[model samples]
Target: MTKIKICGLMTIEDIDAVNQAKPDFAGFIFAGGRHHIDLDQAIKLREHLDPRIISVGVFVDAPIEEILKAVNSGAISIVQLHGNESEEVVDYLHDKNIKVIQVFNPTDEKFNTGADYTMLDSDSGEILDWKNLLIIPDILAGSINSANVDKAIKIVKPKIIDVSRGVETNGKKDINKIRQIVNEVHNS
Candidate 1:
């Protein structure tokens, strides 16, 4: 089955909606940026989530110490490195029994060999080449919506699919849209 992951969740409401949707993974951004969430907030959200759903912490080029802090805080079971982190970092985390996901911007080509999963996203919500990723077991992101999701999935057949801005309407996530995307992924 193609797992679905919803990223950049920022509120209790968002968490509630995502939980209702029952995606395989719910991502919380912990790195310093617009989508960032503090440890306390993430911990509170984590506590409310069903254990069946995996909690993922999104980070970008953070030091191992900082990543460890997130793990210890109960913010995440999986770590997603969205910046220029090294393979050694992925290896070290895996050694500690932490699953590591590596994110690749559409233009990056140096694939890290040790990551548990690889995710492809556009810098902006623009579409990118899905064909180039056909061989990789990855998560497809960037401008993915109910309309184009089937096409992307048919071409890439990723192990998982992720969406953030694509599932939102009027700057907020729409439950109907989330359902549509999830349904389309499963049906396709």
Candidate 2:
């Protein structure tokens, strides 16, 4: 089955919606962006999250200390590195029993970084050419929503489908959009 990941969750309402929608993963961006949340905010939000849903912390070349703080505080269970983090960083996180998802662009020739999982993202709000890409990713992201989710699944056959803006309305996470995308991914 293709699991669903609702990314960039920054509010208790978002967490509440995901709990109802029942996505497999809920992502929080610690990196500076529109959806970014502070450590304190993440901790508070995690309190409302469904225990069955995994929390993914998205970082962009963040310090290991900061990453550890999130995991140790019980805010995030998995780390998704979205920058030029070294394989040693991945190894370090793994040593601490933290699962890691290494993000790579479609233009990158190599995908292996010794992380627990691989995530492919264009980061450009445009879906990648999955068929032309050489490997089947563990997670596929970038402009994914209910409309194109089925096509993405058919082409990539990814283990997880990640969505952020696609599940948003006016730059905020919309419950209806989340539910619609979740249904699409699960049915696919």
Candidate 3:
């Protein structure tokens, strides 16, 4: 079955919702976007997260020190790189035994290629041409929701289905949306 990740979680309420929904992974955007949460807040949120579900820290052009701090704090178990992180950086993180997910645009040639996982996105929230791409078991992200999730799974067949805005209502995580999306992907 395809795994689900509800990304960009901000509040304790979001954590509680994810606990109920029980998605495979929950994301915390620490790169200071609209869903950005501070280290202290992330620590608090981690206390309430379901232990079975993995916690991922979404980063873009951030320092390794900060990423290490989050990982060491037990708030984040994985790091998803959404910036122009070099293979060296990936190696550095991997050398420390930290799991990494490298984000790609599908057209970007400069990639870390050594990531445990790769997230493919158009940044426009539409599913990319999976046929044009090679390799399976990659994570598909951007603009994924309940409506198109089934199609994405059957067509794209991504190892993991990732969503953030698609599971939100008025810029916050919605439990119903999260559950619906997960069910749709799983059923597909």
Candidate 4:
């Protein structure tokens, strides 16, 4: 089965809604953005989540110390790097026994570097050049929704699929859209 990850979760309500939706992974953005959450709020949200669901921390060029602090607080499992972090950073996180997911635009050649996983996002909601990603493994396409997720899956055949803005309607996640995207991915 293709793994589904719902990113950019912000509030307790969002957490509850996503928990009800039952995605394989729920992401918390600790970096500054519309979806950013504080450490305390992430801990509070993590407390309410079921053990079967994985909680991920999203960071963008944050200090390794700060990332470690979030990991220690409530982000016990995965960390997704959405900025220009070095392979050394990934190695350090790996040494600490934390799963690292590196994010990149399709044109970035560094995606092939060592990391537990690599995600490709359509740099401005535009579809990526899938032909350039033939040999990459354990890749997940971001900015995916029910509309283009099937195309991404068919072209990339990624082991995982991640959606954030695509699943949202008016700044809130749509459960039916999440279900639709997941279903289409599986069926494809």
Candidate 5:
């Protein structure tokens, strides 16, 4: 089954919802965004997160030391990079034995990343044509939710599925929506 990841979590409510929904991954943004969280908050949130649901810290061009700090403090179990980090940067982090999820354009073909996994992101809600990329089992993110999640699973067969605003209402994570999306993804 494809993995489900709920990203951009920002509050205690968001953490509680994730524990209940039990998605494979719960993401906390360390980048610039309305949902961005500070290291202290991420650490507090991680303390409450269920151990079964892995925590991912999302970054864009963050320094290596910051990523290492998060991992060392147990604030995050995985790092998802959405930046211009080079292979050398990746190799540096991988040398620390931390997992990395490198984000790329939907049209990218190089597939030359040294990260543990690569993700496709459109920034817009547009889904990528993922048939040919199935061999890599890369993670997929963009605009995704219950309504179209099953279709995404059928078409992308992504190793991991990511969502942010799609699982929210009024700019806050909705428990019902989260559960619905998780249930749908599991059944798909």
Candidate 6:
């Protein structure tokens, strides 16, 4: 079965919604962006998160020490690298028993990051050619929502379907949308 992931969780409200919706994974952005949250906030939010939902820490070229700090805080169990991190970083994280999701573009010729999972993200929510994709992504994430989630699961057939802006309203996570998308993915 394909699992669901709701990303870019920022507030305690977001944590509560995901806890109620019960996605397989919940993402917290450490990377600077509209969804970015500091370590302190992430730790607190993680405390409120459902124990069943795995925490994934998103980073963009962040120092290993910072990543370790977040993991040590018990806020993040998995790491998603969105930058040009070296393979050594992936291996190092694995040594620490942390699963890694290495992000890549559909156009990238090579994807030998050797991380636990490879996620394809356009970053602008642009849907690319799923049929022509060279690799079968472990996680498919780009403009995924309730409307197209079924089609994505049929085509990409990824192990996990990740969403952020798709299940939100006014730049915040909407519980109804989260439940809708989660139901769609699981039922599909």
RMSD in angstroms, all models?
Answer: 1.6, 0.9, 1.5, 1.9, 1.8, 0.9
* Per-residue alpha-carbon lDDT of candidate 5 for residues 1-188, written as tens digits (9 for 90 to 100): 77899999988899999999989999999998899998999999999999999999999999988888988999999998888788888888888888899888766666546889888887666765656553344787878878888887888778888999889999899999999998888777
lDDT of 4 by residue, 140-179 (tens): 6655678877777777788888888888889887777777
Once fitted onto the true fold, the runs of candidate 3 whose alpha carbons sit more than 4 angstroms away are: 134-137
Off by over 4 Å in 6: none
Off by over 4 Å in 5: 129-137
lDDT, residue 155, model 5: 82
Q: What is the lDDT of residue 82 in candidate 5?
A: 86
Model 6: per-residue lDDT, tens digit, 121-148? 8776798678788878899999988888
Weakest 10 consecutive residues of candidate 2 by summed lDDT: 127-136
Query: In model 4, which runs have C-alpha deviations exceeding 4 angstroms?
Result: 132-137
Model 3 agreement with the true structure over 32-150: per-residue lDDT tens digits: 86888999988888889999989999999899999999999999999999998888889999999999999988677665679999888887767677667654548998677888888
As for TM-score, the candidate ahead, 5 or 6, is 6
Candidate 2, overall lDDT?
A: 0.91
Candidate 4 residue-wise lDDT at 26: 87
Once fitted onto the true fold, the runs of candidate 2 whose alpha carbons sit more than 4 angstroms away are none
Candidate 3 positional error at 109, Å: 2.5
TM-scores of all models? 0.93, 0.97, 0.94, 0.90, 0.93, 0.97
* Residue 88 displacement in candidate 5 (angstroms): 0.9
lDDT per residue (tens digit) for residues 1-188 in model 1: 78888888888877888777888898899787667888888999888876788999999888899899989888799999989999899999999999999988866767786899988888776897788753365788878888888888888888889888888878877888877777777667
Clash counts for the predictions, in order: 0, 0, 0, 0, 0, 0
